[model samples]
Target: MGYGELIIRSYDAQNDRGRVEDFERRCEVGPAKRVFLFTDTLGDPMCRIRNSPIYKMLVAELDSQLVGVIQGSIKLVTVHKPPNDLAKVGYILGLRVAPLYRRRRIGLSLVIKLEEWFIANDVDYGYMATEKDNEASVKLFVDKLGYAKFQTPTILVNPVGHRRFRISPNVELAKLKIEEAESIYRKFMSSAQFFPIDIGNILRNKLSLGTWAAYPRGESWGEVPSSWAMLSVWNSGELFKLRLGNAPFSCLMYTKGSRFIQKLLPCFKLPGIPDFFHPFGFYFIYGVYGKGPLSGKLVRTLCRFVHNMASSKSKDCKVIVTEVGGSDTSRLHIPHWKLLSCPEDLWCIKALKNEERENLHELTKTPPSRALFVDPRDV
Candidate 1:
C-alpha cells in the first residue's frame, strides 16, 4: 500500500452507500478492553450531516475499494473573541478507516483532504472530538495535524428503563413552541462558544422532539422566571443504533441480577439496567441552560421528564445522553450512570488560516467556559 496508490474523492451515495456502510461496521469505537461500540447508521451514511447548513463527505480509495471516510460541516458560530465574537468554523466528524488500513496513513489522508475542503470554503477553523484516552486519534489530530486540545466535555448517559419520576409539584413544566424555543436560546445562549447561528432550523427539524422549560408554577414563557431551566431533545435514536462490545463479566452480572430482581419483585419497581450488549438507541439532550439557586432542581426535573417520555414512547431507546463541558455547573444536575458516562471527552481545534492564529492561540490558552454548546447534529 504505497502512498501514491491511495486516492481520495468525494463520496457518491448511489455508488458508495453499501461499501461505506460496510466500512462503518468494521470501525468500532472505544477501547477494546472494556466496551467498544459501533454505530449502525441504518443504511444512510449521510444521515448525520445531511441536516447541516453546509456539509460534505469524502472517501478514500485503494485499488477501487473503500478504505476510509470522513465527513465535515461548515457553519458560522460564536467564539466570543475580541473584535469578532463569531467565526466561520468547520466540524470534522465520522472519520473512519477500514480495520486493515490502520497506521497506513489512510486516516491522515482523509482528514487532510477534508481540511482542504474546509479551507477552500474560507472556513476559519476546523475542530473534532474524540475520547480522551484515544491516543491514536489524539496524536493524529493534535501531534501531527497541529490541532490544539481545546475543551474537555463530559458525556452524561442515563439509561431509560421502566422508571418514571414524579415532577416536583411546585415546579411547572411547559413545552416551548418552536418560536419560543429559538427566542429563549438566542437570548440566553448566544454568548456561549459554538452556539449555532441557525438554532431555529435545529428546533424546527423533525428529529427535534421539542424544547421544554421548568420553573416555578406561577411563572410562564411570557415573563421569564428568575429561577428556571430549559433544554431540547434530539431523536438520535432514529439516526443510529449503538452496541456495546467486550463487556466485563461483572457488568454483565450486574445487568442480569438487576433485571432478575426487578422481575421477581414487581412491586419494588427497580430500574434494571438495559442490556447494552445488544444494539440500542438513545435520545440526546442539548441546549441545556439553567439559572438561580433552584435551577439545578429544574434541570433535574427536565431530565426526569425526558426519561419518562422516552420510556413510555419507545422500547428501542435504552439511554438518554447529554454532553456538557467538564466544568459546567449544569452537570451536577443531569442524571447519569457513572459506569456508562465519559468524564473527559476531548475536543481539538486548529486554525486554517494564518490570520486566525491569534484567535486560535487565545482560545487554546483560555480554559473552556461552562457555556460550551454541544451541537445535537454533531452527536
Candidate 2:
C-alpha cells in the first residue's frame, strides 16, 4: 500500500460525517478501544471535534483513498491555576490515528501539527495524556517527540464486588434531598470557584445517584459548614462521587471536572490538570474552596458519606480515585491511602515563542518548573 499524503486543516462540519465514519472504523482497532465514541445512535464518539475549543482534523490520503484520520483539541488548562510565569496553557486531547497507518509517524506528525497550532495561537504551554499501559503511544511521545514526563497521576483499581467502606466518627453525614442539595449548591455558588453546576447537566447525568453532606458538632477548624458530596453511578458499572472541603481522604472520591470547581471553591489549585480530564468513574472528595486545617476533616466526613452511599447504590462498584498536588500539605498527613505504583504521566512542551520566552525568563529566572502531568480522571 502506498504511504498516504497527510493534511492538517481546520474542521469543516460538512466533512465530519465522513470523518466520523472513518473514526468509527478506526475504533475497531485495539489502539482506539479506550476512545469514548458518542453517536446520535449508540456508541457515537463522545468527543465532538466540531464542538471542541481548538480542534484539528488530520486526514491521510493514500494515493487517492482516505486511509487514516486523527482528531484532537486544544483547550485552556482550567483545573489548576498556572504559575505567574506560565499563565497561558493549552492541552491536547482525543488524539487517534488509523491502525493501518501506525509505525509511519502519522501520530507524531499529528501531534507536531497541533503543537505548531498551539505556538501560532500564542499558547505558550501544551500538554497531553495517555494511559501508562499504552507503551507504544508513550514511546512516541517520549522518545520520538522529545516530550518529558511531567506528572504521573496514579490509577487505582478495585473490584466492583468488594464493597467495604465506612464513615468517620465525630461528624454527622446524611443524604440531602435533590432540592435541598440544589439550594445548598446555589447558596455556595457565590464562594465556589467554578460556579453554577448546570442543573440541566446534573439532571442529564442520569448516573447522579445522590448527594451527601457533613457537619461538625464543635468548633473544629473554624466554622466548618456541613461538607457535601455528590454520587454519580455510571452505566459502565462504576460508582463515582465528589467531596467538598475535606482534603487528603476526600480528594480520592471525585474526578477533576467543572462540577468539582462548582462544588469547591477557594481550594488549592493542583498544578498541571488539563481541562479535557473528565471525572468519569472517579469520585471527587472535597469542596473546591478553602485552604486550612479544617479542609482535611471536611474531606474525611464527605468521604464517609460517599462510601456509605456507594454501598447503598450497588454491590458492584468499589474503589475510589482522586488526584492531589504533589505539594498538597494534606496528602502528607494521610499515611494509609495507598499510592498507586505507576502514575499517569502529563507531557508538556513550551510553545517556542520569542516574546513568551523572554517574559518567562524575566519572571522565573529559569525555565518554568515542569510538572508530572496527571489526567483528571486518573486523579
Candidate 3:
C-alpha cells in the first residue's frame, strides 16, 4: 500500500507502544559507513516533549501497520525584535519513518498533520533541527515544505571517563537554590535568543539535577563577579539511552586496548572509554553563560565540573552533551571531542501564519547572537 492507504492519527501510548518501538529500532540515524546512533525513548516515545506545557504526537498507519511518526510542542520564546517581545513557537522532533516506508510520502503526511495542529494552536513559527549532512531531511523540509534554513548550531559532546578533571584552585563552585538560579538566569540571560519564558519550570523539573555557579572563593552569590559563569544540568540519561552502530575497527581496538592497559596498571589510572557497544545514557548541559576576560576559563571549568559530576553518577552516563549557536563565544571554551561531536547542526523554520512570514524571513537573515539559550526539554 502507498499514500492512498495512509492514515494520520494521534499516537496512543497504550495501543501504539510496541509498533512504534519496533519502528524506531529499525530506523538507524547517521551516515551508513561510520557509526550511527539510535535513541531509545525508554518505552515512552513522548518523553522528549512530555515536559512541555503543550505538546502532541501523530503517527501514520499504512495497510494496518504503523509507518511513520512525528512530535511537536509549542512554547513562548524570545525573538530578535526585543527582549520582551515573545512569539509562540512550535518545535518538531523525533520524526521517523520505517525503512520500507521511505519514498511513500508517509513522512510528509505526518509532518503536514502535525503542522496543522501547530496552526490550530496559534503557533507563530515552527522549526526543527537535523544534522547538516542529512541530505534527505534537508531537502524534505527546505525544498519540499518551503521552510527556510534558520540557524546552524553545533552539538558538543565529550566522553565521561573514570578520571576527574582539575579545576583552578582559585575558583570555587557552589550549588544554587532554584530561586537563586532563576534569578541569575533571568537577570543576565533574558535577552538571549530563544530564551524560554518557562525557564523556571525547566529548572524545577524533577529531571533537572541542579544549577551551579562558579566564581572567586571569597565571593558570595549576592555579589556577582565579572568573570563568573553559570550552568544547569538535565538528567536526560533517565529519559532515554543512546547506542552506536557500525563503529570503525580502530575505535574498537582503542577501547579494548585501553581497558586491558588499565587492568594491568591500576596505578596508571588511564581514562578508559565507556562501553559504546551497549546502550548507554548521557547528561545534557544547558544554559551555558559567561562574561569578562576570565569568563572563558570559568566556562571551561564549569564544563569539566559537569564531566566529573556525570562520571560520579551511579547511572551509566557515557557522555556530556550540549548544543550552542555556531558563532556562540562560550563554545570556544566548552570541552568536546571532535570525533563524537557534530560541527554543523541545521535548523529550519516556517511561519505557520501567513502574516508572520516577514518576521520569519527577518529571523532567518539575522546574525546569530554570541550566546543561545538551549531549552533542555527540546532534547
Better of 1 and 3 by TM-score: 1
lDDT of each: 0.91, 0.44, 0.86
Task: Name the runs in model 3 displaced over 4 angstroms.
Answer: 1-4, 82-84, 266-271
TM-score of each: 0.96, 0.55, 0.96
| Cα-based lDDT at residue 145, candidate 2 | 76
Question: How big is the positional error of residue 338 in model 3, measured in Å on the Cα after superposition?
Answer: 0.6
Error of 1 at 378 (Å): 0.5
TM-score result, candidate 2: 0.55
lDDT of 1 by residue, 173-218 (tens): 8998999889889998999989999999999999999999999987
Ranking by TM-score: 1, 3, 2
- Clashing residue pairs in candidate 1 are none
Clashes of 3: 0
Residue 74's lDDT in candidate 1: 93
Q: After superposition, how far is residue 272 of candidate 3 from its true place, in Å?
A: 3.3
Question: What is the lDDT, from 0 to 100, of the residue 313 in candidate 1?
Answer: 94
State which candidate has the highest TM-score: 1
Instruction: Flag regions of model 1 displaced more than 4 Å.
Output: 1-4
**Who wins the lDDT comparison?**
1
What lDDT score goes with residue 32 in model 1? 60
